[model samples]
Target: MNRTLHRVGAMCAAHPWRTLTAWIIALVAAVVLGGAVGGTPRDDYDVPGTASQAGTELLRERFPGLSGTEARVVVHNPAGGQLDPALLDRVVDALRAVDQVGVAGPAQPSADGDTAIIDVRYTVPVTDLGADAMDQVRAATGAARDAGLQVEYAGQVPEGEPTEGGLGELVGVLVALVILIIAFGSVLAAGLPIVAALVGLGIGSSGILLLAAVTQVSTTSPSAAAMVGLGVGIDYALLLVTRHVEGLRAGLAPQAAAARATATAGRSVLVAGATVLLSLLGLILSGLAAYRTYGFATAIVVATAVAAAVTLVPALCAVCGRRIVRRGRLDVTEPQRPPLTARWAARVGRRPAVWAVLALAVLLLLGAPALTMRTWPQDAGSQPTENTVRRAYDLIAAEFGPGAYAPLVVAVDLAKVPQDSVPALQDRIAAVPGVATVSEPLLSPDATAAVLTVQLEFSPQDERSGELVDQLRAETLPAGAEITGVTAVFVDIADLLAERLWLVVGVVVGLSLLLLTVVFRSILVPVKAALVNLLSVAAAYGVLTMVFQWGWGGQLLGVDHPVPVSTWVPLLLFAVLFGLSMDYEVFLLSRIREEWLATGDPFQSVVRGLAATARTITAAALIMVVVFAGFMTNADIVTKMIGVGLATAVALDATIVRMVLVPASMMLFGRANWWLPGWLDRLLPHLGRRGSAELDDPADAAPATEETASLEPAASR
Candidate 1:
């Protein structure tokens, strides 16, 4: 694999313009092809096989007009008097003027006589409509307020807030620019990673857009791809570029340095990317379309990044190798010296147990909050105060009740029950523990089904609301009643995910362990890696729960109030975090493993491996943190949560897992760290050649004495 990668890199270096031109052509093709093939992203929250989904399907088949998106205009007589008949007509007239909307019902007056609701059905699905269509609706509705009525609109209102909500990529790039400039002290060298990331992301995102034609890719998926792609993309390119610089210092020619760098670091990047994509692919085990699409989209972007890091980056490096030198003609004239990281590793190795225990304690403390973590789907109530959704929610809560905004639909199969028994069943349903009120049941055309709207006292995402759903579902009601509605659907979603959460975790953990075992060719090494990754991921979850759920410093992340973690967040976070956390684990251990093999001494290998890779791991992790953290600027709370969660995980993984737990654990294991059962060794395929090559040990590599470490030449001439 190393030789193959080196050959490809060498070819690209030899024909830099050809490589760059190929990438440019690919980028343009992606953009043009994506626009031509792709459709709008789907954000459906329906969970198949759930009662709510069943009810929705029944409704769509039976009541097409009622099932589509409806805009509800709630207007009140500010004078506390009867509404003028002319005023209602004017509002209806305004709604009728809109191209996408047709009146679903005449004005339905409330018991107070001051408040009324007018329903208008949209011609197209709400998800398909753009901001312009919504703007027209808003304008038409806003005119009713001019007639001295307090008008508020609810239901689907142009959610097209640009799927690329957070400009996190720009901020991430800026942060990377600073970190790279500091790390390399060369502006040209610092920019290469960013250039590669943007190019890769641009093409990858376009590809996701193209995917919308075949599958329901959520609008957020592209932004998610960008977020993951940028952080890892920059780090991947940085790894190769850094290696290239070292190659130049080793007295290799410009083309050979680029080729060598690609051969070495490019191999690691490929492994890291494969692991990430594999982990992401674990989302398919969820059996949810959204998860599947999100995972697949992100994997595509990561693949593109890896491709660029191995090919385009090498070409760029070759094109500018001589200019990369600050001093004339790169040369390592003086003997090299061990960096601060090497010294730190040596010091930590002296008392590995203490550092390990301390790191473990800290991780456990942070992860404790995860034990109490809860999940829910955010609704209009969770929106910011300035948002239209929030305003409509508040108005409904004030006029009717919070539950009115998210009424539970109790769909009963009348075919299984007698007609005369309906009244008695309705009474029993109304008497259910959490039922605040029950609307008059609407019978189907054949009277084979009935839909009853049950309003509760609590909001959709409220803990009490979830309890109410459980209470109703548990009830042995007649007519084979099934609970369905916005709230009920979310409850079902949470229930479904919770039921399978352990299963998904098992799959991801199993795959990661297997992959690590294959890559490192050791049983214990992979086990240790999985255990530490679990700790880091848990710690990240705990901190996010404290901040977002507990509302500790939640405002700093743009969320003004506390929120339960979104129903899908845990599963998605686990898949992503497990893969990402493994990146640092792989980065550090692969180097250490290389050292261990070279020196045949576990203790020195641990010290030297930590010393050699700490700076690189830290720099990579820092770039990721900045990129993920920048996503907090997005308006969507869910996106903000994802950003904060990922950032926190990377930070913990790099410092605790890489710096402390890893070295300490390896120290305790001694030579056992490389143990593979004789039978298992034969069972595992020898994925040879592309194996790790980071070595400075005299035994297996160039003798990296303190005097010559800084000036060490590329191994094996």
Candidate 2:
């Protein structure tokens, strides 16, 4: 792997412009081809084998209109009077005339007579609606607005607006650039990684767009993919660039330095990328089409990032050559003092048990909240107050009861249950403990199926709403009746994820253990890494629970009140964080293992490895945390949940696990940290990096320790 990467890096570096041109060509081709043939991302909420899914499928076959999208035009007379009936008729006529609309209802008026709801149904599913669906709805309601009526929209039709992001992502990139400059103290070095990351991101983003052409990619997938891609892309490039700088300081020629850096750091990059992709494979095991699309989209971006780190970064480094090095530092001949990180490592190593115990305590405390974590699918009620959909949700909750905002649809197969028994079924459902009201059954045109809308006493976001759904499925409804709607579908999705969450975690953890063991040639190290990463992930989940569920600081992130954590967050976070946290682990452990091979003293190896890679790891982690946190600015609660969860996990992993626990634990374990059973070692293929041989000079090595028991006292060092 090292030799092959070395040759590729050298070739690219030796012909810099050619390499740049090739990347540019690839980017352009991807964009042009994607624009011509790429598919758009559409959310696939279908969860097979679930009752909600079955009901939805049944409706699509027998009563297609009810299965499609729906919208509610909420109108209110702010002047404290009943609305004009003629004006209401005009509004209904306007909506019914809109393209794609299957039906516009007789407006349902509030008891106070001040507010009314016009329910509109589209002839197609939400995903099938065109880009102008919302615009068309808005245009139809303009006349009502013009006549001094307060109007708002809610439900699936209004939910399709493209979420506002991009700005936060752009801000994150700019911040990353600044951090890189400060870390490297060279503008050229700082710019190289950014450039490489951008090139790769271009291709990755284009690829995601193209992917939409073939599969059902969720609307959220692109943003999620970009967030992961950008952070990892910059981090991967940073790793390679840092190593190239080390090569230059060691007096290697520009092309040789680039080649050697690629041979070593590039190998870690590959392994890290593979781990991320492998972790994403667990998402495929989730058995949800939406999650599978998310996994594929994110994997594509990560793959491109790895490619650019190995190919484009080295070429750019070679092109810049010695200029990447700070001028005065290159010619240093005096004995260099230990950096602050090395001093810290030595201190921790001196009292391994103390530091390890303290770090574990802190992590456990932070993770405790996860024990009470609750999850539900986000809905319009969770939206910020400033949004029209949120206003619609609030208005409906205020005037017509909160339950009316998300009424459950009970689909009945008329063939199994006679039409004469339909009235009895409705009365049976309405008698259930939580049922608020039940609408008269509406039969399909063919009279083969019928649907009854059931309102609950509690709002759709309430836990009782979900419990009620469970009650209806288990006891209340007849055999021919299946409950499905926005609320019911969400409940079903949550249940599906709960069942599959363990499957995903097991796959990711088990596969990651295997991969890391092979890469580091150590069983304990991989096991330790997994354990620590789980702590970080749990801590993140705990934080999310506090902020979003407990409403500890929900207002700060545009969350007006406490709400359940998004259903998909825990599963997604586990898959993503396990891989991402392992990125730092791989870089740190790879360096430590390289030093162990060179010095054959585990104590010094830990100290020297900490010193060598600490700064790079810190910078990379900061970039990732900042990038992930930036997404908190988005209005979408699900997006905010993901951003906060990822940022928290990365930050905790970098500081608690990497800085304190890992070194202390390594010191406690001593030589056992790298030990592998002879049989297992023989069974594993040689996949570890070239290690110490990649360095051009022994002068680059950290100062040797005299005692192998632990680092010398900070004073003596």
Best by lDDT: 2
lDDT of each: 0.78, 0.87
lDDT of 2 by residue, 269-346 (tens): 998999899988789999898899889999999999999999999889988877886775555453467789999999
Q: Candidate 2: give the clashing pairs.
A: 39-212, 39-213
lDDT of 2: 0.87
What TM-score do all the candidates reach, one by one? 0.91, 0.95
**Regions more than 4 Å wrong, model 1:** 70-85, 93-103, 107-136, 139-142, 145-153, 156-164, 167-169, 328-337, 689-717
lDDT of 1 by residue, 588-607 (tens): 88778778777788988888
Worst-scoring 10-residue span by lDDT in model 2:
705-714
